[model samples]
Target chain A: MKFFINKENLLFAIQSVQRAVSQKSPLPILTGIKFSCEEDKLVLSATDFEISVRCAVPATVEESGSLVIPARYITEFARRLPDSIIEFEAGPDSTMAVIRYGDSEFNINGYDASEFPSFVIPEEEFSFKLDADLFKEIIKQVTFAVSTEESRPVFTGVFFEIVAGRLTIVATDTFRLALRHTAINEETPELINVIVPGKTLNELARTADPKSIVEVIIGKTHAAFITGEIQIIARLIPGKFPSYRQVIPNQFISEIKIPLKDFLESAERVALLAGENNLLVSLYIRENHVVLNMRSETGWIREEIKSEVNGDKLEISFNVRYLCDVLRSINYEQLVVRFTGPLTPALIIPEDNKDYLSILVPARLSRE
Target chain B: MKFFINKENLLFAIQSVQRAVSQKSPLPILTGIKFSCEEDKLVLSATDFEISVRCAVPATVEESGSLVIPARYITEFARRLPDSIIEFEAGPDSTMAVIRYGDSEFNINGYDASEFPSFVIPEEEFSFKLDADLFKEIIKQVTFAVSTEESRPVFTGVFFEIVAGRLTIVATDTFRLALRHTAINEETPELINVIVPGKTLNELARTADPKSIVEVIIGKTHAAFITGEIQIIARLIPGKFPSYRQVIPNQFISEIKIPLKDFLESAERVALLAGENNLLVSLYIRENHVVLNMRSETGWIREEIKSEVNGDKLEISFNVRYLCDVLRSINYEQLVVRFTGPLTPALIIPEDNKDYLSILVPARLSRE
Candidate 1:
């Protein structure tokens, strides 16, 4: 596009959009960033069929024009350019452009923007305002439990359920489930449910500013998030999300409280002794303390850490990786482990945070 | 055997030796770290046939004994263990050991020390002392030019020449050469030349203390460096190193001085457009400015930067990677570029320093 802007401003805009550029797209144009110039601003966008991102920066537009430049070259070039005014002029042909800064000038090749697909967000009838930090935290806690395999599309997404002035997000790969709920002020006409791909949520969590207010718009098949200077849209994973409410246990035979950091540190070391693939570790609930035991062909490690225990004594074995993930995603000091039985799933929650919870199914201890 | 050692001290000793642990050793004992406890100190060592490293740390030893534990497991376990006095007690048999710290304990399996090879350094008839920082700096400047391919064993190591009161290190892959020399006061019985493997030099550079005096001992089949609390001995690559004195021309047809950072920044951008495999770029050295041009199947980029020229104009092309490496490794503000011809090699040296030099051969330019 024919525009003159600051090097830093252009670089920031390009980086925000280039995150969605596809490295192995079937169509080569999708690997480029479409640049458009209007009267006083320039817009940049990139898409990979599933997720699209766009950002606009203030620039002096000489003439309204558009072009699609290779994202990699443009980003690297702009980043390396000295901090000064950068001039971009679209060439007469569809395959060339000129960039000038100080005494340095480059005639770069580009594709016509006419061949690029439109990334305009359609008008949506339903939308809600949410805190960026809270949304990011919910995504962090739930995204880890989403199934990585694509065979079951529903499990590959984080389930979103909103009703009665509260929002709850759930994700599971059948072995473990993470559920987090937070109170919101938005009024809904009815209960709303949607399945967002884990990839999109992760990107949103990365790009969103902690203190910024994000407006989430849900359309027929697509969802758009409008943050500070960027807009990200992604197509929803089409399928019915699993009902995880029934998977959580309602009663517990024993509940023990342990320091979160201590427990996570011990489990991490114990997992190392559990071999590489099978991360099995046993937890024994005693009257005064709790013990973590891990064994493999290499050796066995037993860690006894002081804890506050109540209710019936029990012993359970689980994949220590799940427990570590839950602990890392939390910012609380103490974690309560609620056990239903040795064979069933256990509920783990932050001692001071009632809105967050995780359920991990115990694995059968193997005899070596 | 039993001993109580601080976790941090034990961790450091294990890490220093683990660098030589062989991942693909034919004998499994070579993959373990041999621990020898006697009197009031513990020694840890590992060897991979080509290189051997050992370090000792002070500890209270109740009984004198030795054991070889898997390097990977012991290092990782000690790193995760809480920072405290850790008690280690060998089982009745060499195959089992118990480690306790705080309330955590681990029963680990290990191999007997009898299977480990001896890494004792023989009495050296000749030795020289050098500053660790100076030695490390010399290695950093010249080692990048070492040939990575094992087909040419001679080029895979850095050529070390000691004569009179000077030490010169040279490395080259034939395309480009990096040579650096420094003055030392160590009295040598006679002039000596040896080739030290690049891997060994790199490890030595990383582990050597910057402020300590390093004692270098040259043996018939190996070279040993003793610094601080660590001793590293590496087998030398046997072969006649190519004479690079003839490659460094004494006279130059033209010499151009340029601001190192400014030149590097512009060249980096031009290199990005040179594509993946061939990073070819041409520098047009005019009377007042230098123009860098890069062309590939994807596109072409041109950048012109100002410079101080003192001779006839010339145009030369080179693989920008070699030039970039020299610039990044140097801390000098001004760089003097000496040119012989468009086809011959060029010399680059720090403007204020005479002990460092690099010669880069020009490449055939590809016309757009």
Candidate 2:
């Protein structure tokens, strides 16, 4: 393909699609980025058979053609090029392309465009639009709880449930769960649910433009996220997601309200004494204060913070990492934590917002 | 021991001495930092058998004693503590210490201070003081050429030669050499030469305070760098450093001056196409311009930058990484490169500075 484009534009387009390039595929062409130059724009596409990304940038086209270039070389070359117009022209065989800027040029070998795998998004059954920032926030709130264990494939993704105009997203790793609720602009005729791989959700969040709107389309086996000039298609995880609603406790024997910053900082300090792998810390819920305690082979730490507590006093232990994750994810001045018993999971929510919550299961205190 | 110190002061003291704690030493006590509370100051010391560091901070000391605490725990605890006066007290047996701040406390287990390795700086044979910023800058300019190959232990250190008031430092891996010279205020009566381990120099640079003066003392078997409230003592490498003066050519047949920005950028871009391990790139010096070329298995790249060439046409090849290192390290607007022949080494010097220079041996061109 023959085209001329600004260096910054080319760099941005490559970055958006580079993550989808296969690292160690048996088919070499799968490791390349397919470049297609049309009348007024150049489109770049890459896929690893699991997720595909496509990005387009405006350019001056001299001829309409296509080629698949090695991702690494093109990326580094584009990053080092001067901030000026870059001229790209393919040879007659279309296997070699020359990139020129000022007096410098790079003759790069590429693969035949016909050999690249075609990326096709299946027909969508439900579609809706959401603000890109809101979508990113929703992903951030839930994806951390997604299970990294591959044995239970269904738990490795974030569950998305849509009923009417409200969208509920949840992720659980059997021990902890994160749930968030938001309202999308579009309403669907019927209830729609899908499980998206957590990795794809993270990539989508990273590439989402805060000022733009994201169109999310869900199909039987695939889902697509289209933003301003980029589109990401991810394969939906096929399996029945566990019912997370049953995991959250509805009643609590003790409820405590504490300043978010004080509680988070205390937990972080007490966690320093926790075992590296177990990360277990005990919390004693009293009438006027909460005490956090952890013991390692070398030492033990105890931290106490003031809190407004009600009901019977209780002591519970948890993997402090989970507590820290939810504590950092929520942006609030204070948090309300509810506990049914020492062994039951605890519910933590922002005091001012009811649409978001996180549940963490308590671990058995080893010292006891 | 009992003392009270501000959280920030304790954190700074821990940071300065933590680097000397051994990660996997045979003596477990070496992995801990020795804290000594005396009169009105708390001193922290740590050693890994090769290097030792000590830092002191002001504190309100009620009792005078010492203990060795694990480095990792103290570092993390200090980082998480509130920004207020922290109370520290040792138990009766001195095997454990309690750190209290606000209503929180940490009981940390530690070793007996008697078991800790004592760090001692021997009587200095010669000493001199240099500006901390200038010393750090000199280290940075020469340390990059230090050999990483453990087989050649002598080359793994930077050679320091002091004659009169002039101090010269040289480091080389046999393929490239970086040399720098500066004059110190204090001159010794006799010539003093020593080879300091590159790793020690790097740590010294990292810990040096820019606004303070660094007093460098050379003893029989050790060297000490003292700046502000921190002191680092390192064992000198025992070996005869090679005479590097012969490696640098006395004269050159071809000298070309080029803008540092253009030359550096072109080399960086061309280096992308060079072999991953060899990093080979060819430079063709013409009458008015220089062309940089590199060929990979997949493709080739060529870049031409204008230059002021006063020598006959010549072609030479070099490992682009060495070129890029000196280019990035030197702060200059233009560089004068002198070449003796296609197979000899080349000299690169900043246009405005004469106290620093780099010698890079050329590689054989594979294509020709």
Q: Considering every candidate listed, which one attains the maximal lDDT?
A: 2
Q: Which pairs of residues collide in model 1?
A: none
RMSD of each: 2.0, 1.9
Off by over 4 Å in 2: B276-278
- Writing each residue's lDDT as its tens digit, candidate 1 over A1-368 gives 57899987898899899889999998998989999889998899999978999999899999888999988789888889889998999877867778898888887788889999898784684678888998888889888898999999889998878888888889999999999998878877788888888999999999888999888887768889999889998888898887787888999999999998889889888877766755889999999789999878888899998999989999899988887777777777999989999999999998988899999999887753
Clashes of 1: 0
Give the per-residue Cα lDDT of candidate 1 at A294: 84
A80 Cα displacement, candidate 1 (Å): 2.0
Second chain only: TM-score per model? 0.96, 0.96
